[model samples]
Target: MTPSVPSSSRRARRRTAAVGVLVAAAVTAAFALTLDDSAHRDDTPDPSAVVTGSAAPPPADDSLLALARRDPSDALAVGRADAPVVMIEYSDFQCPFCRQFAQNTEPELLRSYVDRGVLRIEWRNFPVFGEESEQAALAGWAAGQQGRFWEFHDVAYGEPRERNAGEFSEEKLTGMAREAGITDIGRFQADMASDKARSAVREDQEEGFRLGVTSTPAFLINGRPVLGAQPVATFTEAVETAAKAAKAAGR
Candidate 1:
């Protein structure tokens, strides 16, 4: 017969196991940042197409995929609520690469996949710059309150602007609101300063941080992480492949 282990020894082993599990979880979440920092920059002009390759995305954590709300009434989102493929974008208005994606790639995805009801694009306000970035996020949400979020997005990203400058000041944001066709400037200012807007922006920022996203223009295509402002082909391939997989699995 074998000798029994001491109770104290068993307790220590259990504690070790618990710590190991937590460490593993943190590592898994942080792996993306390791790849992201080495491979991409926020303002790189001719950046690489995809960090993971043009091939099919690897299997992702289910919790990551569930981040997609797909609310049909989500003012900041565009495309079908039940689209098979959802591309969730975590971006900052002050980030040049984010602007590049917004101006160059997003429209193509809208025309090709979103219009066809094969993809949905969800915008997450992930402000990484500073106070100006946070205020801009709040401003975007305020525009959404008036059903002009995309219009505001277009105006904000219409041109490349310096980060942390006066580009996103309260007055500048108000001017952008008017440009985006917000009828009530008074209400827009009120909404932008409201607690609800701050909460909304905070919620989005927390989600990005939880995923270990350390930069602007990060994306999740059907739970698969796609870092940086990749080319339109990269987005196209991701969308199509995810669509096919969803169809095969009867999603």
Candidate 2:
């Protein structure tokens, strides 16, 4: 039998893994902090390149990847083909706060908008860490190709450090798709590896940069940008504002 790592050692490993993601996610987030912290990177030139290895996602150093690697369900959906409003998320897997939002916050939004038919949700991958983050996003996208984007996205952030762990691995994503009820895994895998899917992920990141989204959980509602893990009220207000604007435009 394998001995469990000491709690302290395990925590140390998680914190160490989290460090690289913090730097990458913080690259855009520093602006929201004090002036000293605000000295971080902003306005990236090309987001797709970053997510695709120009910068690469971070390595598996934390538990978020482990959490993300678990088999995900096929309960979530991306984009609002039927929604009057669109909500886009700029996210990184290793960010603990994103995980919290996924667990505590997103559920409410789903009950209200995602299910209520008021809005559409779009998952935009912004892997800032290095290879691990990118790997995780790719896995989730693969799940999306299998028509399980939300299930994969939901479970991913729940992971404390499974950025590129077992289930989240490229090869393992197919199994996750099957678990998520996907019947055509081969087709899904092919789609995920296609340039169109890659372009979709990249376009999202590029648009996020254009909209000043430098952090995980930033939202673009009906074409407007809202940054950070804002409160539910903030999201409500933004949605209402966008809705009202769209209504006035007769859209």
Candidate 3:
């Protein structure tokens, strides 16, 4: 499945090529009377052709989070030792829809949960594409090394989809990291080549397969799974349920 288009790119920059015309006919030798007729032609394509497919069913996000914590070396989970709940997200950087989900739907989540320190968000890097994808995920994790993971992920996904070939070249990756406020660029580059970064990509892909997450932007809140670029309301409900469950378990 294609990544969700980011709200900014889709809503602001998309262009329409339709034309508008105005015509007038004059009648008279010295001073002619005028007739006015204006018409606009409609050629917009039907949305139903692409929009008719059955929506992919939503999965449980809580169970999925639990399933992801199996490997102690998972990239994002290592540092968040005291969080009440962990959030595991399977994401691709090139997906436009993933960009949309990050830019629009994720703000409220970050503000209330992550910023408040109630939930820890861990990024899992599963690159669906070839080199560009894998490289992008690695660079993103490298950005995380300098405390810029969220910034890099959010910004990269929103950038124009790169040329597929050579998209994740070292120059490109470092450039993107620099743009996302990652200082100490030398360390970031080294991290990209280390076993740490490559393992993150491979492990994410493996866990995704085991959990049937065959697509980008799959999410695991607590131990359950929610796939695709879902609405914000969906995530809110899942998080609330997870919090309640944790509370009940402690009791």
TM-scores, one per candidate: 0.82, 0.61, 0.68
Ranking by lDDT: 1, 3, 2
Overall lDDT per candidate, in order of appearance = 0.82, 0.57, 0.61
Q: lDDT per residue, candidate 1, 151-210, as tens digits?
A: 999999998777787999999999999999999999999999999999999999887877
Q: How accurate is candidate 3 locally (lDDT)?
A: 0.61
Query: Candidate 2, 178: how far from true, in Å?
Result: 4.1
Off by over 4 Å in 1: 1-31, 35-57, 61-63
Regions of candidate 3 where Cα sits further than 4 Å from its true position = 1-65, 68-80, 163-167
- True-vs-predicted CA distance for residue 184, candidate 2, Å: 4.1
The deviation in Å at residue 4 for candidate 2 is 80
In Å, residue 88's CA in model 2 sits off its true spot by 1.7
Best of the candidates, lDDT: 1
* Each prediction's number of clashing residue pairs: 0, 21, 15
